[model samples]
Target: MKPVVQLLYFGYHQAMSCIFPVAIFGTLALTRIWEVPFLHRYDAILLILLAVQYLMYSSGLETWDEIKVICLFHVIGLALELYKVHMGSWSYPEPGVSKLFGVPLYSGFMYASVASFMCQVWRRLRMDMTGWPGGMASFALGGAIYFNFFTHHFIPDFRWWLTALVFVVFRKTWIIYRVRATTYRMPLSVAFVIVGFFIWAAENIATFLGAWTYPDQREAWRMVGVSKISSWFLLVIISVIIVAQLKHVKAARRAEPG
Candidate 1:
């Protein structure tokens, strides 16, 4: 009973740590049923999401630093969204007052939400990393991976090469996270795969909620392919590296369970 309670306590806080993402995705799911007086769905989504973000900051769920990181992700995500939408990888089908370059403004929040989650998780779990490949290597790898997301359309995709690079760079790295009173460790590469798998699951939910549609899902809603997990896995690495720089990522100590 004590162990069960401990696990539940950790789970609850873990969920709470994702309040920003929960709010964003939850709003995305809810707006399907919500009726607005004059606002288009996309516009409404942007407004409500912005409001929720501010609320999280004001309510102290997110610190100013976390908000800053989240904003950075918004820009990065938005840039990628613009490129992807332009390339016809996927699209925003609904008409939106806030649309620019065929990408809805709220679309960036999807990326911001990932940043928010990472920031909150880092703070809440007291995360650290060991054997990191150093800032320069990590940043260089991240840049190449991000570039591939765009250049793949016109050039040969180097994702497999980048994926191999990740292993070469991070093979010795491990993430240490505190859960409840216990500290646990996982290989950085394994963590990427796990987080990426979950992100793929979230993408499926997002598409089903009409947040956006892939080229394949426009006619009929279908499961996002399992293969996309590789893409998401690579994306999570980018997010992790960004947050690690901001959070002073380092090796974890042997913290005893309380």
Candidate 2:
């Protein structure tokens, strides 16, 4: 089998495998494109994350800087996740599945890609990255901690608590740098459609794969039009955006007239 052909096939399923995530995401985007009311505060985000994920998949990574930072986190995360998988930290719906990269795709790939998309969403939203370096850099340090999560060093609850704590610290540091980032006024109608569609896609994909085991999801095969994964994904994306935005703000300050 040709490597190129194999890649294309893998890409196709990889993208298709995320159909639920996409459908939820698309519903969010198309809705915004048409100028509709948001389903909720999170509607716009669903659109953004899924959009970025699909774009990354189909276009083969266009943003070098974004992907670089995102992938940097991914490689670290992958190491931890792979170790967990080997040690049985968590089990997937699919058993013993490995990917072409030999690192396995069932869970790790989804997280890195999904988190990457979420990061872009937050960056575009200007939620996290614009802030003072002292505390901001400290939080940036936490990304490493998050990367350290799932490794043998930290327990799962410890990692989760640490993430929440870092987010709080990052938010406070970000407030200090509040004057740093350029704020854009987004249209309410546009925001709603885009966010709603993307979330819809993500949820759909999760449900199709039996990941949406939430009690509220009545339809076994079809998503409930809402799910925890969307919420979690949105949170992660916002966290990424905040980190990137602060980095941007720090860079801009460095370039300013002294």
Candidate 3:
């Protein structure tokens, strides 16, 4: 396909991905729309990341505080990705990135902004960060999983400096156990740790076995299929921990405390 044709195709594909939800919302606006949920009405935990605006409006969480956090996460994520792509850390499926940062400016904003909102919805529905003890364990475990999916071997040459992160973060977090976990806590933590380790190992093995290899992977770390999965894993885990520590949105109450 020609470059122009590819751009057109991407635009159309992105449109379709975005259109269905808007269409549903439009229909609801016309109809009685009785399904307006209070807060996290359904288990859209990850799904909410897609239907952001609809949930924001319907969930009655258009407050400034919520909006600020959503905006912050979006901006940060977009900036981080854009920087990474520009620095040759990764590239998108489409060359549309450079149109703004080589992609389209507003286009990037639209998607990133929407994702930020979804994070808020997640926090609100997760019961507002209540009793989150064993949190660091999962974050330590899950985050490594996340980074591996995209850039398993793309670590910086100087990153060996960060090698001491494990001992440092672990010791600090262990000492500052301000919060606590409930019944579901241990299981959730275990899930992320196991998943992170498994995926990290798989990525490494695949590379060795010639499955998926990181082409621009750092020369220092690229093994046939072996690389230290610790950084990405720890990075992910720490990120999750930070997010867990953040405030969650509360379901609105019918009776005003006043």
Candidate 4:
């Protein structure tokens, strides 16, 4: 295949994989401009996301297992949101029946969308990894990264240290993905950075749509700081590790003797 054709094919697959996230962002943009009668914006978003999840499953865009994974990330994200809001890292600053301790229930779907993208892209691209660093190592690193998000509030931030460890842990790892008949590989760490950067870009859009407000944005809407990319980078690592571990487990079960 020609280079331009391969690039187009890759872009097509990436867009297809982004259906869930695109839906979420589209809803954010629409709800920002259009208000619903008898429903608060946040409540309406929650309802819309519920409907979207159902549609995705019914339409065979996501498998049952993928839905479960997305739900897990939803819970994880909501937990983080609750803590972050409590710590004054950011806030919803909106009234909604669906608000839990200040965060709208719909907010979790933002994180679930990330999980949905990971699962979708992995399947669409037929991605596999070499030098996986084993399940225990990956999960431990993931757990540490997650806890650091909260602990950093009370203690000194360890994100840069964690970032360094990520490089060391994934130094030998490479993700292999297929685009059409041709296969390509990239350093897994590099993939993390790329995904994180895009999510940071999306975060800027989400904040602009009034999804939430950071301390700086409460006065006026401004671009999210570039420093957020590091946070998202670690988050992308956790998401990837969880998805990769689940895929490994499924593969192991399939390999088991019947």
Candidate 5:
């Protein structure tokens, strides 16, 4: 295939893989512009996402296993949101029946959307990995990264240290993905940064759409700081590791004797 054709194919698959995220963003933009008569924006978003999920499943755009993964991330994300809101890292600041301790239930769908993208892209791009860290190392790193999101608030921030460890641990890891008949590989760390950067960009858009607000944005909206890329970078690592481990487990189970 020609280089231009391959690029187009790659872009097409990527867009297809972003169905869930796109839906969430579209809902955010729409709700920001138009108020629901009888429903709060957050509650409306939750309902819309639930309907979207059903549609995706009914249409065979998502598998049962993928849905399970997305559900897990939703819970994980909600837990983080609860803690973050308590700690004043950010606030929903929106009134809704779905609000729990000042955090909206619809917020979990944001994180679930990331998992949805990972699962979809993994399948669409025929993704594989080389030199994946062992389960112990990967899970431990993921755990540490997650805890740091909370611990950093109370103790000295260790994000940079964890960031360093990520590079060291994934030094030999590479992601293999296909575009049409051709396969391409990139360092896993580079992939993490790429995904994180895009997520940060999306975060800016989400904030602008009043999906949520940072402390600084209480009075007016502003771009999220570039430093947030590191946070999202770590978050992307955790999301990727979880999805990868789940895929690995499924593969291993399939390889077992029936």
Candidate 6:
């Protein structure tokens, strides 16, 4: 393929495979603006997301294993949502029968969608990591990041410290991804920051569409704070760790003697 075509070809597949979850978000956002037939916004979002998952599986766009990982993300995300919403970090302003403790069940799909994107891209790009830190350290870093999201509300935030630690740990790490016949590599930390910005952008889109709202956004829509990029950066780290352990282990296995 020509260089341009090669890039487009790879992008096309990546977009198609990842589009299902994004479609759910888009559909919900559109529905919030327009009328939808009987269901409430939260209910409609949940139904549409579940339907999309089924379609992706039945159409072979996603595998059962990937679905399992997405589901795990759903649960993990919901736990955090429950706590955060209760803490008034943000809220689902819309009323719905499917809500639990002020959190709409479909809200979990937001996090699951990120996992879906990661899984889709990992497979599509044939991603591998090199010079990775030990599994225990990765887990510790990821765990601290996840906990800091909650504990920081009451305690001193450790995010800057953790961010520095992430640099130290992943300093030598590189992500290898294949595009058509070509393979490319980039620092894994760079990939995390890039993906983090994208996710932050998506969060702004979601909030603007009335999917949910932070305290300040309830009255009027605004660009999500740039400071949020740091949060998403940490989240991408957690999400990457989960998917790497679940899906990207093949790269390490390939290096072992048969």
> Each candidate's TM vs. the true structure?
0.93, 0.44, 0.38, 0.99, 0.98, 0.94
Candidate 4 residue-pair clash tally: 0
lDDT of 5 by residue, 1-258 (tens): 499899999999999999999999999999999998899999999999999999999999999999999999999999999999998888998899999999999899999999999999999999999999989999999999999999998799999999999999999999999988989999999999999999999999999999889999999999999999999999999999999999999999999996
Tens-digit lDDT track of model 4 for 1-258: 499999999999899999999999999999899888899999999999999999999999999999999999999999999999999999999899999999999989999999999999999999999999998899999999999999998899999999999999999999999999999999999999999999999999999999999999999999999999999999999999999999999999999998
Model 4 — TM-score against the truth?
0.99
List model 6 lDDT by residue over 159-255, tens digit each. Answer: 8999888899899999998988888899999998998998898888888888889999978899999989999899889988888876546556777
Q: What is the lDDT of every predicted structure here? A: 0.89, 0.46, 0.40, 0.95, 0.95, 0.86
The digit string of per-residue lDDT tens for model 3 on 1-258 reads 456765564445444433322433343233223333442211222233345645654666455554554455445456655665566654433222224463223223333343342344333333233334544554554444444434534753433333344434444232111111311223333333443465465445433432222445433336433354544344334444544454321233424475
lDDT by residue (tens digit), candidate 1, 1-258: 878977887788779877877787888888988867799999999999999988899999999988988899999999999999999999999998899999999999999988888888888888888898888999999999999999999999999999998999999999998877788899999989988999899999999999999999989999999989999999999999999976664222224344
Q: Output the better candidate (3/6) by lDDT.
A: 6
Between candidates 1 and 3, which one is better according to TM-score?
1
For candidate 1, the TM-score is 0.93
RMSD of each: 4.1, 14.6, 16.1, 0.8, 0.8, 2.0
- Ordered from best to worst lDDT, the candidate numbers read 4, 5, 1, 6, 2, 3
Which pairs clash (backbone N, Cα, C closer than 3 Å) in model 5?
none
RMSD of 3: 16.1
Native-to-model Cα distance after best TM-score fit, residue 89 in candidate 6, in Å:
0.8
Instruction: For model 1, give the RMSD to the true fold.
Output: 4.1
Over 4 Å off, model 3: 1-51, 54-57, 60-67, 93-98, 103-164, 171-184, 187-232, 248-258
Clashes of each: 0, 42, 18, 0, 0, 0
